[model samples]
Target chain A: MTETELLDALKAALGADVLAAGGVGHDLWAQVAKGRVREALQLFKGTLGFNVLVDHTAADLLKWPGGHWAGVWDPCQATQGGEHERRTQTDGRFELTWRLMRLDEKSGLVEGRAALKCRVSDGEAGPPSVRDLWPCADWLEREVWDMFGVKPNNRPDLKRLLLYEEFKGHPLRKDYPIAKRQPLVAPLPAPEGRIAPEQLRPRVTDPGLVE
Target chain B: MTDERDPQTPGPGSGALTQGSGPPGVLTSRLDAAIGWARKYSIFQYPFVTACCGMEYMSVASGHYDMDRFGAGFPRFSPRQADVLMVVGTTSQKIAPILKRIYEQMMEPKWVVAFGVCTCTGGFYDDYATVQGIDTIIPVDLYIPGCPPRPENVLQGLMLLQEKIQRQGLHPKPGTLRPPIR
Candidate 1:
């Protein structure tokens, strides 16, 4: 289906939950209410046949003016480029995003793709974990939690994946100090024993040496 | 049981180099000098390599640079067997304690050579994650300065360590002071 047809179908199905739908570069994108994200993502996967969860990530939006996360016209979006501008703002909140792809079963080709974004406020719980629908979402949700400190509801293993357990804060957050160090109090034990140098001995069977 | 030759006389092939005719064919030197000479020539090194400088260290160990000529060719993986510790990269604060432990584990008569600018002064990583200098943790015998020091510079540093070892007396404790080299 085309971007418009899919979007219209979504608007009809999700109604007020579908806040805005438009074209982002060559792909269709939609911003939904944070509470309705799980339902919207389920519709996209079950009804629209966007079965493939291509990627999932988040952005910190703390620095935007008055907690107003910058949008397409914002100068901060220009740093990366125009293509990324549409999804750059969260109005002083975290923007959680997921890219989903629709693949044709017969041809084994990608028929369509869409980006779904949801604004999650600071200290507010994020969308429900999609791990039940897409198994790959397990690690992706963990990564989002690790980097942005966004808690995905019902995620079984939401521990830190990139940083060590002793790491104090999420590094990707804008507030995290760049130069702050959290060194370990004690070092891991090293292997014991002495390694001797390789030994070299002449062969007794050598005719020249035997004589 | 004495032969006809006089004990006071310089023996054949002595070439008039005998001092005070102390003993024929016997050379005399201080105990410290003899010990220093032996220690200077056999430096078993433990290369605590963690960054890009390890590439240069590889070249120094390989046939072209020939680190064996300076008697520091054997790269001991264990700290217990090594006589010298060559720290050769950017040591992060996380890894500093490990380096300290390795330095402590080495037997007495141990020396440390900071083999790159990063190991010596943390190089460009002047941040909280990097240790500003290894000396804050353990004493460094020599510092070889380079982004990733050239193999020649590493060899020069090794030679300097050898010279230091030769000039100083071996103390019973590992980190004891010795008289300054002239």
Candidate 2:
């Protein structure tokens, strides 16, 4: 249908779960409840034809000193004069931004995109996994867990994507120390069956040995 | 093939020695100079490329720069085949162990070149995620500092590795990764 109808469909289906909805031009966005994230994503994919999960990542807002964060979201919420007017984040330290776009059914060209955001504060068991809706969400969600320490519930293979397993804290978190380094797995010993270096280069000084 | 029979005693393999000035040089050069010279010039380098510096490495190795002139033209993808570990970019904490493992896998008398500033001292990525300097993990023979370094700088680093290669000699230490001498 039209751009307005898609967001309207989301609102009609999820009701109060659609906390706030707005768009400037075609950049439609909505703030949905954290618990209902999977349902909202399923709605976008199932009925709305928004098949592409463009991006899924989180921002740690602990030191955000927030206001308008780069998007022209809701003019009323825009704090003036650049003071430390911390924007309310639903009592969560982290916000997950999921951008979904749909392909035009006939032309196969992309028609529009929607930004679905939900805040997940610490001490909560993060948001529900949308990997069930989109397979790509599996790695994206794992990356979020890898970088921000926010694990999506029900993700089976929630392992590190970018960092090594021995990596300690999520470096993306605001409070994580900038210079702290966890000890590495001790440099591995040479693999078995490999010839020793000394054996590789035997000492030979008796000029007679060259014959 | 007697060293005692010596240079004065030239009754050998058509300079049968001459074919390689080589493979026989590999066996004969145990005399030191020829083997060291061969190893220095024929650097089968393992380009452990991980970041933007890779672009510079490719340019340096390409025809315009002619890394082949230095005898280090061939890039061995397997660490076992490579003697020079050209650590060509940022070695993050994640890749540090893998880098070390590759270094471990390499045959002895191997030389490591930290080919960029991020690899040298972690450069602008002085963050928790990047290894502060690869030297903190694997031993480095030369640190070529620059943000991804100019192709000229990379060549200079390669030349330095060649010099180090010439000096490490046939005498071997099993696993201790030593720093560059002066």
Candidate 3:
């Protein structure tokens, strides 16, 4: 399906959930409803056959003017064989993207991407866990929770991944100070020559002078 | 009682430089050259990838500027057989000990190449969780600096290791300071 046709289908199916639909760079990104992500993604998968989940990663949406942005790539356009033996014409293929992709070789591929805006708040519930759909999403969502304080609800493991268990705040958020330094680990008796006293030794004067 | 030496075996004072003779420096140098050649041609490495720079490391190993041509192929899983440790990613405080253990498990005469800004000097994460530099725990032989260094820079570090091995014969430089040899 063409980009416009796919967008129309999404709007019709999702109603008020579809925010903005326009070409962004080489692909199409739709500002979507925060709660309707799974439904919108299922529509793209079931109707258009965008069955490949290229990658799922979250970006600090605060970079944008509106909200947090999560990106997912669709490999529905992937084809088999040489040009002469092409299975189908995918010259200017449209990648239908949401937040997830369900893989099934027999049905062919449909581009799917889903993005939901998240509010940065200690009080805000994390984005719903999509581990049931894509297991790797478990880690991705936990990272978001740990880095941005955006909790992914129903997540089995919500502990921090990049920071120590005692780390108090999410370091990636805009409000988090860039200069805050955590207390240093207790020194390890400094490697021999690195300490002041040991560093004073003179260099060996002969080639045969073993340490 | 001292045993008499055979006439054919020559006396201890003889400046004997024949095959299977004393002072194996020549033999050792030859062996070092061969190992040096192997080290240059095929530096099979186990990547301790952990952060953003790892992506760039993968790019170097993949297409564009394939490192495989020079024999520095990336092996994800660490096996004792691999001698070169390419710490291409960040090391956390929790993971630092693990990295040290992995380094120790590697056979002797192993070389470590700290790739990218993080592994080289902790990049900008001078915090508690992330290790400031891998060298703090493991002895690093080469440091490649870049926030997320390009593939060419990684290859440059590999070449630098090769040059060091060829010139120094992979033996620690003589009289270059050491912990008093017991």
| DockQ winner between candidates 1 and 2 | 2
**Cα RMSD for candidate 3?**
15.0
Question: What's the lDDT for residue B51 in model 3?
Answer: 80
TM-scores computed on chain B for all candidates: 0.83, 0.78, 0.74
Task: Report the number of the highest-TM-score candidate.
Answer: 2
The local lDDT score (0 to 100) that residue B174 gets in candidate 1 is 48
Docking quality (DockQ) for each candidate: 0.08, 0.19, 0.07
Clash-forming residue pairs, model 1: A69-A91
Best candidate according to DockQ: 2
Query: On residues B30-74, what C-alpha lDDT tens digit does candidate 1 reach at each position?
Result: 566567767878889999999999999999999999999987788
TM-score of each: 0.64, 0.75, 0.48
- Model 2 C-alpha lDDT per residue in residues A1-211, reported as the tens digit of each score: 6656877898798887787666644567788888888888888898887889989999887744442254434432442333222233456888888999987878889878888988887756677888778889888988999999888877645788888887887988877765466746453344345355357442323232111
Write candidate 3's Cα lDDT for B19-49 as tens digits: 2333534322245555566666667688888
From the highest DockQ down, the ranking of the candidates is 2, 1, 3
What's the TM for model 2?
A: 0.75
Give Cα distance to truth, residue A155, candidate 2, Å: 3.2
Docking class of 3: incorrect
